[model samples]
Target: MCLSFHSFRKLIASVLFLTFFFTGCKNSEKRTVKTEEITFIKEGELSIYKPGTDVPVLNLNIELAETDYETQTGLMYRTSMKENEAMLFIFDDVAMHSFYMKNTEFPLDILFIKEDMTIGSFQENAQPLDEGSLSSKVPVQYVLEVNAGIVAEKGLSIGDSISFQKL
Candidate 1:
């Protein structure tokens, strides 16, 4: 069929518009994967011992986040942490520490430890994805994040001490 310039241009534009519109709708359709799968992270082990003695209670595989960037992004997108796993945050000075659970996918129990190696405070069973700040009532140099309820399961207390070695 012979067509004029205007009809040809309009046909071409209509075809392009329909192609893009259908393509966009297809991309927006429900995806097969409901949630993004996250990989588990393990870097080392941290042993939590008795309050004052060296007697060991339990050892947790841990991922250490020492630098400023790592500390800021701690466990934000993880789907879960093993019962025997934890994340440790190290800082230079003993100061009040605060934590929030934005983008976190699972609950955690945060342990705040003083420079002298004693547990100074705890934020237990912190809900996942919460932005509320969890605090160390006293100044602390280290912070530990573990699967929620691990502390109570092991009967951990305020004075419990930890010893860790990197893998």
Candidate 2:
């Protein structure tokens, strides 16, 4: 077929435009995936205590999940946590530690804890779905997760202490 230069250029441009448009749409759709829930552990009781004031009067409700599944799920789907609410993650021993908010829906404050019950370090304002690893500044035996702003509200400091019991 014989065509003019202008017509040929127009045809090529149309082809290119459609190619780019469909490809762009497909890629965008892939990016807009619906996030699903990941259950880490089974249901159990967890209790939190202020590190070591020698007074065990006040305690908090924690979902105890020592197994891989329970610990992995953690508190990813919960919409709200109470003012006195906390999650105590227990490990077999104190070791180098890190955490990420992959499927989590709420912002959190993470407290890396030592065997002595002293605060190893604190990651305040942990963003939801953030994959960045919040590493412990020191080796930690346990990790306490609370609502993002709760740490400052409670006047919790890096050197502040914490403790827990499996109920």
Candidates' C-alpha lDDT: 0.89, 0.75
CA lDDT of 108 in candidate 1? Answer: 93
Model 2 stretches with alpha carbons more than 4 Å out: 1-59
Q: Report the poorest 10 consecutive residues by lDDT, candidate 2.
A: 39-48
Give the alpha carbon lDDT tens digit for every residue of 33-133 in model 2: 66564433323343334545565433566656477876787777766577567777888878888889987888999988888777779999999989998
Residue 108, candidate 2: Cα error in Å is 0.4
Q: What lDDT tens digits, residue by residue, belong to model 1 across residues 102-154?
A: 99989999999999888999989999999998989999999999999988998
TM-score for predicted model 1 compared with the true structure = 0.82
Best by lDDT: 1
The total of clashing pairs for model 1 equals 0
User: 30 in model 2: Cα distance from truth in Å?
Assistant: 22
Q: Top TM-score: which candidate number? A: 1
lDDT of 1 at 143: 98
